[model samples]
Target: MRCETIREALSARIDGELEPIAPGALDRHMATCAECRSWYRRASSLHRTLAAQPEPPVPDLAADILRHLPPDAPLSSAS
Candidate 1:
């Protein structure tokens, strides 16, 4: 795959969201492309940082948030 395509797929690849071809293409491109490798490192690092920080809502916390919504409001994904 081309650099443009690889760049587009890098984040998805890092997130394990890519189809098989995209991940393989990402790996192959990273091997030979320093720029993409650096991009992948930065993207991976940020993903890890953000992923680690979003503590899942405790049951009580979810309930509390839900309690504050309008009575007719649909329950969010939180509930």
Candidate 2:
């Protein structure tokens, strides 16, 4: 796969969203591509760190905060 294609799918790869074939291809590309490898390393580190953390207790204002957010605002996919 091309570098651009692999980069576009990087988030999915980090999230374990890619199918077996695509992930294998992405892993091979990362092995050979320094830039992509670095990106993968960073993303993998973040995934591990986040995974290690316990979910925070929900605040009483959580629903209020969500209610105040603009409906049209783009939500981040990371959550």
Candidate 3:
């Protein structure tokens, strides 16, 4: 696979959402492409870090509060 194509599909590849052929192509490219292998390592690290974070607890009133907010209003207290 071309480097551009592999780069484009990297995220989906890491997420296990790529088509079988795409991943196989990416893997083949990665085997011989240093740049792509570096990129894959970085992407994999980020994916693992994000996946490791605990899911935030959902507030019972969150939906009700969001429903009443103006469409253009800022959502955070700092805003």
Candidate 4:
């Protein structure tokens, strides 16, 4: 794959949001491409750091979503 394609997919690839790529395509490209490799490394580190973080507790998640519905909802402090 080209470096442009790899650059576009890097974040989703690091997040594991994308379908698996042909295995060696990524390895071969990254081996020769310094910029893409550096970007992937940074993105991978960020993904790891975010994944390692403790998830924030969201009490009554459904209620929170419903309560924030537009039009009829009372203004939230954020507004």
On TM-score, the leading prediction is 3
In model 2, what is the error at residue 57, expressed in angstroms?
Answer: 1.0
Across residues 10-41, which tens digit of lDDT does each residue of candidate 4 receive? 76677667635654777778789999989888
The 0-to-1 C-alpha lDDT of every candidate, in the order given, reads: 0.77, 0.79, 0.81, 0.76
lDDT tens per residue, model 3, 1-79: 6677777788777887854455666677878999988998998999999999999987699789899989997887682
Q: Rank the candidates by lDDT, best first.
A: 3, 2, 1, 4
Question: How many angstroms is residue 46 displaced in model 1 relative to the true structure, after the best TM-score fit?
Answer: 0.1
> Over the stretch 1-79, how does candidate 2's per-residue lDDT look in tens digits?
7777787788776776854346678778888999988877788898899999999987699678779889986567676
- What local lDDT score does residue 36 receive in model 4, on the 0 to 100 scale? 94
Give per-model TM-scores: 0.57, 0.54, 0.62, 0.59
Top candidate on lDDT is 3
TM-score quality measure for candidate 2: 0.54
Clashing pairs in 1: none
Tens digits of per-residue lDDT for model 1, 1-53:
67777877876677778444545656777899999888888989998899889
Against the true structure, candidate 4 has what lDDT? 0.76
Q: Rank by TM-score, descending?
A: 3, 4, 1, 2
For candidate 4, which ten residues in a row score worst on lDDT? 14-23
